[model samples]
Target: MRVLLVEDNGDFALPCRQLLAALRGVQVVQTAASAQEACDWLRANPGGWDLVVVDLFLGQGHGFTVLRECAGRPPLQRAVVLSAYADETARQYARKAGADAFFSKTNEMDALLAYCLQLAGEVDGANR
Candidate 1:
């Protein structure tokens, strides 16, 4: 599975990468630190990613913009919001903007990984 990870914190990236590495069938992972970069990457590689994991507060832009950019993606393409600000309001907004799931960085890391693994399994199964 190909993933585009949109996160700004260098501190968080390494841990996230390590977690992803433990998952089977996660072939390629890309990172973007800003909303503009995420949008540009999506445009440049249209229908190229299997999953997108985004943070709400970016160094340059918000994750909502990235969600909007992914609104028209294929059914197999998934977008999820993993943010520190995972309040009810933020969750609702993320869902409205087109996120498949919203997880809190403070407490829901395991859930996020499980969801990713589920998606990866589905993709791998379908490809076979």
Candidate 2:
């Protein structure tokens, strides 16, 4: 499974890559630091990506715009919000904006890993 991780902070981005590296058949194809960058990638690649892990706050633009860019993605493609701002309001807005799931960075790292693992399993199974 290919992933596009949209995170501007180096600290969080490194850890995220580390965690995702442990999963078999999962590769982070690219990392975008801003909403425009992510949107550009999406437009350039269309179905090139299988998953997008987005952080709400970016250095140059908001993750919400990135999420909006992911609207009407393919069935196998998913967009998830992995952010520090995982409050109820954020969750609701993320869902409305087009995130397939929302996971808090501070406390939900395990959940994020599990979600990725599940997708990897499905992808692996289908490939088999």
Candidate 3:
């Protein structure tokens, strides 16, 4: 499954990338720093990405715009919000905006990937 990781934090990006790299069947893993870049990439790579993992707080304005831009696309239906801000509002907004899952950056990324794998049927989900 091709995945796009939209995270601005370098520290978090590396380990996440490493973990995804270890997982099998994840063909294209691209990382973008901002909402604009992500939106542009998505438009250019439609039907190319299976999932988009985005951060709610992009250190800029609302990152919801990125999700909004991709929500209408068929292949972009699978999305997850990975953010450091673990607020109810953010979670609610992400869910309402069509995020398949909401994950705090501090949580186990394996769980996030497992969730994605489950939603996409590309890899083993964490279902015991």
The runs of at least 3 residues in candidate 2 whose Cα sits more than 4 Å from the true structure, single-residue gaps closed, are none
Across 33-117, the per-residue lDDT of candidate 1 in tens digits comes to 9999999999999868999999999989999999999998988899999999999999999999999999999999999889988
Q: Per-residue CA lDDT of candidate 3, range 16-79, in tens?
A: 8777666666644688888888888888988767878888877655568888877777743578
Candidate 1 at 99: error in angstroms?
Answer: 0.3
- Residue pairs in steric clash, candidate 1? none
Model 2 Cα lDDT, one tens digit per residue, 40-107: 99999997888899999998999999999988887778999999999999999999999999999999
Quote the lDDT for 71 in model 2: 87
Go through the candidates in order and give the clash count of each: 0, 0, 0
- TM-score, per-candidate, Cα-based: 0.96, 0.95, 0.84
lDDT of each: 0.91, 0.91, 0.76
In model 3, which range of ten residues has the least summed lDDT?
A: 119-128
Question: Top model by TM-score, which number?
Answer: 1
- Tell me the RMSD of model 3 versus the true structure: 4.0
